[model samples]
Target chain A: MLSENSDKIQLFKYLEGIFTELEQQKIALDKSAIVAFTDIKGNITYVNDKFCEISQYSREELLGQNHRIINSGYHEPKFFRNLWKTIARGNIWSDDIRNRAKDGSYYWVATTIVPYLDASGKPYQYVSIRFDITKQKNQELELVRRSKQLEDFCFIVSHNLRAPLSNLLLLTSMIQESDDSEEQKELIGRLVKPVHLLNETFNELVESLQIRQDTDIEKVNLSFKDCLENAMEALNVAVLYPDIEVHHDFNEVPDLKYPKKYLDSIFQNLLSNAIKYQSPKRKLQIRIKSYLREGSTWLEFADNGLGINMKVQGHKLFGLRKTFHDNPDAKGFGLFITKSQIEAVGGMIYAESTQGRGTTFFIKFNAK
Target chain B: MPNDPMKTIDTLYLIDDDDTYQFIVQRTLNSLNLVNSIKLFSNGKAAIDFLEATLHDIEQIPDVILLDLTMPIMDGWQFLEQYLRFRPRIGKKVVIFVVSSSIDPRDMQRAKSISEVTDYIIKPLTKSKLISMLHESLES
Candidate 1:
């Protein structure tokens, strides 16, 4: 009886040791990972400090709430349904989930949910262990975007380069065959335009590539009025567009930190496009405005000119060599270059237009 | 195919965005004596619109179409999709050949996959290539 009592005591001590080890492991996991417990119906029951920290929700707010409270809506319904189906069958489900925080900021987490089963092998509760993977996920997305950009770059280069180059080849071949002096002279004259076009295309492409690579170009704080005047002076817009009327309101956001050349180029391109595409029925009118929204400075240019069909041409508006209108001077380079410049420094540019009415271009500058 | 002694296509359509290409191709056709009459369209949309308008007129319909792949309004692929829809309505056999500066194998493969396309020709279409295209159109 004494030995049996001793055996019971020994078993109890071993059980206590195992319990202590398990508690320590739980503590370590809680410190490193976002941990949450939910009932079979996916209602949050418990959450660790890390979970509250990452999700930007208090423990009080999280408990009794559904996991959908933090749902980013990036994933489809089928994704969640599949996950729930897996865990419902007392199986583990794992995936990278993008969750929205209390402040509406997005974060990605590598999540693993294990279902705790009852005696009948049915899930009673679920324990989700998630590690913050936002940084890596963003990097992966950026890499994919960059690769796609490179692919487009290659396609444009090959396609645009070939057109002129092939024309040069054909023109030279014809010139070689022509014995008549007058015909040879005309063919050579014809050769001049293609050569000029090739040079322009090559130069434009190089300029765009340079802008993309020169992300760290020097920026200076400059007045909006001054920048506009500088672009006008550079383009000789006052002389070139004598009848063009310009209006401005920079009271709300007067100055911006940007690369001088890029800003000037963007202004020049937009101004020239507006002027060149003005409707024959109406005089050219331009309105420039600056404001602040969501910690970013915005510059808006609204033009009363010949607007294009946004539905059909919007997607290709900023694409290289994509012209919607039959304007003889449209090389389709202005918007593409402007977009590249803006995007180089984490800025964005978009347009809204109604056909035959007008166009408004909005530029959102990076807060940094 | 052997040189068929300067054979001519009855009516040929040249659809391309590049005016330089249009000029050079027209000149080449004249020099080679390959086409009786040429109709030019700047893009696929214009060409397709012309075809839709002239469906019943056998005289207006092109005997051969030299289609460029990349254009502003509608590309060659989109043109093919639209063409396939109404192609059966046209009574005459109209052969399409993709004439593109794109050397991308995917473009060639896609053009070849279209049963309506007779062939895919890379740009700076040589004298021999133009002659062979003429023979193909004549036979069709």
Candidate 2:
């Protein structure tokens, strides 16, 4: 009877030691990771302090909320469908997820979700362990963007720079074959155009080079109205386009936090294009509007001018060193630079045009 | 009429955007007395319109066309496509000489494959090159 009692006591102590070790491991995991538990239906059942801290939510706010409350809209529905399917099959699902915080900041997480199964081999609950990867993800995205910029630069070198050089060659030939002094003087007068064309092209290239070399941009709060006014003043469009009608509505979104230079460039390019392509049949009419929609700020610039035939020239609208119009001054440089500036700041710009009717451009800015 | 030494080209069409090139070619043609009349168009569209309007009258069409490749409205390649469509209706055996400052091999190859294009000449055409081109056009 004494030996039997001793054996029972030894078994109890062994069980107690295992329980203590398991409890310590759970505490350590809670401290180190952003951890959460959800029922099979994806409703949040429990969350560790680290989860609440990173998500910028109180424990009470996070507990009963669905896992989708933190959805960033960065990933498509197919991604979640695949993830859920994997976890529901009692398999561990792992991926990088972009999540939105309560304060509207974006974060990335390297996540692993393990599903706990019931007796029937069905998942009863899911336990997710996530490590913050926001910094690393931004770095990787920037690197990819920079390489794409380099590829664009190489294309510009091969394509856009050649036109001016062609002009130089033609002018050189003209200078060579001229016999009379008067004809030579006239040819000399024409040489200025090709020289100016080469200078403009080089200036544009140098500007792009600066932007590419130093990716750092200083962002500040910018007023749309002020920026547009400044651009117009600099271009002297008020005097040059006395008959042009310009209208704007900036009540919905008056200001944005962006690089001042980029904003100025965007405004200048679109305005110049509107004026330069104005129809000889009528007075120019341009409308600029800004508003908030679908959690993003949008700017619409519309012009009733000689619009493009999108069906035929849509693909090359913003192509480098391309011109669809017959105007000799149309260097095909404006839209290309505008696109570069917008995309560099994580914004998007697109256009809708009907030939001989009108053109409208939509710019969607990123939500901070 | 092939290689008839007595019949000289009377009319020429210069389709190019560069004014300097237009002036140079006009003066050169006058100096050499190679052609009697020269017409200049800033782009291919105007030339195409002329050709289409004058399709029934063979005399209105130019004897030779010196076409620049990179024009603003319609490029040289596009011009060729449009021209080939109306070739049978036009009823004119016009020789086209592609003139370009670009020495790109792809451009040269592309010009060679077009049956309507008689020759591809690098820009700053010499009098000798012009004579050779005219001779080739006559022979063909």
Candidate 3:
């Protein structure tokens, strides 16, 4: 009898040791992971300290709330529905989830949710474990953006660069075959225009490439008037006739911290476009204004020239190689590059126009 | 040698956005003595409008059309969709060749899938290629 009793006591001691080890493992998991428990209906029942820390919410505030409290709205409704269907059927669900913290900041988590089943094989509760994956997710997003940019670059090379180049080849071939010196001279004359166009397209490509790569280009406080004057000075001498009337108002906002080169290019392109498309019936008139609105600096350029039909051409006004007018000098690169320069710094450029009337462009700088 | 009157295309249409391409191609074809008249359009819309206006005018209708794919206002694919709708009513067999700088296999495959398109030609459209294409059109 005494030996039998001792054997039972020894078994109990071994089980106690196992139970202690399991408790230690749970504590270790709580330290390293954001762990939470929710009832079958998805109401939060319990949360670990790590969950409160990562969510940027107080334990008291998070206790009665649901996972929707931290929803980032990045996923569609179908995503959450599928997740719920899996977990409710007593299965484990795993995915990378983007969540919103209390401070409005976004975070990514690699999550696994395991359901605890009742006697009827239906889930009674779920335990979710999540690891921070924000850094990796951001890197993946950046990679996608870069690949899209590369695709656009390839398209530009094939269409824009190759178009003029093909003309050059055809022109030279025609020149070689002509026995008449007079005809040969004419074909050679045609060659000059294509060659010039090819060189210009190449330079435009290089300039745009430089703008994209110079994301961290140095910026300084610049005067609005000085930038406008520099742009005018850089323009062709023919465009600066005495009849051109210019006006400016910078009282509300005079200076802005921006890249000088980009600002100057933007001004020059807009000024030239206004001049190039001017109507013969009216004298060229340009108005420039700047103001601070809702934490952003806004600049406006309104011109009285041959305007565009907004309904027809608004969507493609900023697209590369898109031209509206039949003007011989319209290369269609100015507005495209202007947009790129503005967008690179988290700014925006848009225009409003009425056919045969005028155009007004609005630029909003990124909030400092 | 006197040129055979029947061998020459009466009216040919060149629809492309590039002015230089239009100028050079017209010049080269003019030198060939195989095309009598060449009509130029900057985009698909203008060409389609002309075709619509001249549906009954056989003299103005083109025997062959060289179409470019990329253009502002109306693209090649959009034009093809419109052309397919009105093709039967025109009552003329107008052969079309898609000439583009795009070497993309997808573009080539798409162009070939269209029954109205005779063939896809990659630019720069050379003299010998143009002659062979014209001859093929004549015989067919």
Ranking by lDDT: 1, 3, 2
Regions of model 1 farther than 4 Å from truth: A64-66, A84-91, A117-123, A213-260, A289-299, A308-316, A319-329, A342-348, A364-368, B2-7, B44-53, B69-88, B102-115, B119-122
Tens-place lDDT digits, model 2, residues A1-368: 99999999999999999999999999999988999999998999999998999999998998888999999999999999999999999999999999999999999999999999999999999999999999999999999998875675565554445655655665567678878788888777877766776676677767655664545799899999999999899779878778888899999999998889889988988998888877889999999999999888999999999999998988676766533223545666778878878877788999999999988999997755
Q: Candidate 3 DockQ category?
A: acceptable
- Candidate 3's DockQ is 0.40
Structural similarity to truth (TM-score) of each candidate: 0.83, 0.64, 0.79
- State what share of the real interface contacts each candidate retains: 0.41, 0.07, 0.39
Q: What are the per-residue Cα lDDT tens digits for candidate 3 across A1-368?
A: 99999999999999999999999999999989999999988889999999999899988898778879999999999999999999987899999999999999999999999999889898889999999999999999999988875775576556666767888898888788889999999888878776877787777778877887999999999999999888888875346566888899998999999999999989988888888878899999999999999999999999999899989978777866622213435556788889999999999999999888899999998866
User: How many angstroms is residue A208 displaced in model 2 relative to the true structure, after the best TM-score fit?
Assistant: 3.3
lDDT at A171, model 1: 86
Reference-based TM-score, model 3: 0.79
Report the CAPRI category for model 1. Answer: acceptable
Tell me the TM-score of chain B in each candidate.
Answer: 0.92, 0.90, 0.94
Candidates, ranked, DockQ: 1, 3, 2
How well is each residue in A128-240 modelled by candidate 1, as lDDT tens digits? 99999999999999999988867766766777778788889988998999899999998898887778777877777788879967877999998899988987887788887
